[model samples]
Target: MKDLPADARPREKLLARGAAALSDTELLALLLRTGTAGRGVLQMAHELLAAPVDGGFGGISGLLHAGAEDLKRIKGMGGSSKRAQLVAVMELARRAIGQQLKEREVFSSPGAVKQYLQLHLAAKPHEVFAVLFLDAQNRLIAMEELFRGTLTQTSVYPREVVQRALQREAASVVLAHNHPSGTVQPSRADEALTQTLKAALALVDVRVLDHVIVAQGNALSMAEKGLI
Candidate 1:
């Protein structure tokens, strides 16, 4: 490896120093672990950089769903190397998504909550329901995934929601769910569920801020529409 050119070497330097000391290509090479028949891991890293799909070629979250087979189709990626790269990318994305929410007012207004939820949940292919817990000042305390299911229903337990809020010591909360069909209109069930959950939470001194429905590129607020 010492005989290789500067760009062709990464792992050795990374081990000698630290990951933060390496460039983007070097980092990618580390993730890749090995190269194709003619290309080295570092070389493949450069290729990925030049053709980044979403955030960048090496954008962690962008490649979360990409398989090793897909990586193999690239010019300089092979079976083992591709698998390693894909796994590394997925782990990076998971860590990034699991990061703690910053200390900010998560939902001071209905519009703010709708905008924030739309960034991720709206584009998902399946249903995801989230509950955002806030304090008296409307600062975010916690955001929890309440349910995951199909278009029709998700097992929403009002008691569990109330319990979680009390555990977090939140003074207010907002409910959010997505519709994969790209329509932001609230269904009858959505309305009914929001009402039921709101009534339940009120007993515990936690105010329901709004119930937001997110779809492709659009979001609707129940409070804004006089529903909540």
Candidate 2:
């Protein structure tokens, strides 16, 4: 009916077409059904996605650094929408952090880390560098992101990771990153980076559990293959 809104309107079509009837924009529009006087929620989401950043949502760890006032600047995003997006971003970061800490013993399974990272980082258009700081028991003390950048230029410093480990008093750590390309294969740089960090942490007596590569539906681990 003409009176039915866009979101409700889409549901009927979805059920009729088995979800294949929707366009990417339509799917995104469904996520944000409401719009403002000048801009619709879908339009705002599109604009946000279009912004140039590493891994797009991949690099959105910076969203944690975004003040409430900053999010309100979007045309159709008021307090609620802004908060929703912010909450989603923050939770993604929190989960990534959690996966890292889980690496002590039970956390030794890279599959677990991959499962967590894939949910948040794989769909991104850029890259995310994340670290998990764990206590001796590997109970998940904290998970932190070390860098966010384009697919090519992320400034991941091993010293910073070492410093954070010392600060958290973590006995060990796990490092992970996402590949927006949907490939779980580790690049030479990825291998080199993990090796570099492993050696650096050795001096301070902290352990490098594993370096995980997360793709859309898959993951690769350095430790499982004896690369670490």
- RMSD (Cα, Å) for all candidates, in order, is 7.5, 6.5
lDDT for each residue of candidate 1 in 1-228, tens digit (9 for 90 to 100):
445865446776777777878887778677777766777766766776554453233343234445666666567555574667566766555444333233446543445566567654665668998998888877777678778886333478898899999999999998999998878899998988998889999999999988889875578989889999
Each model's lDDT = 0.71, 0.68
lDDT of candidate 2 at residue 220, scale 0 to 100 = 84
Poorest lDDT segment (10 consecutive residues) of candidate 1: 54-63
Q: Which stretches of candidate 1 lie over 4 Å from their true place?
A: 1-104, 107-111, 151-154
**Model 2 lDDT vs. the true structure?**
0.68
Looking at model 2, residue 199 earns an lDDT score of 92
Residue-level lDDT tens digits of model 2 in 1-228: 235675556657777776778754455456667666766655655554443452223223333334456556555665676558666755766566565545455465545666666655665557888887778886667667778875332378877888999999989888888887778888878888888889999999999988888765578887888888
How well does each candidate superpose onto the true structure, as a TM-score?
0.57, 0.57
Off by over 4 Å in 2: 1-105, 108-110, 150-154
TM-score (C-alpha) between model 1 and the true structure: 0.57
Candidate 1 — which pairs collide?
Answer: 52-56, 52-57
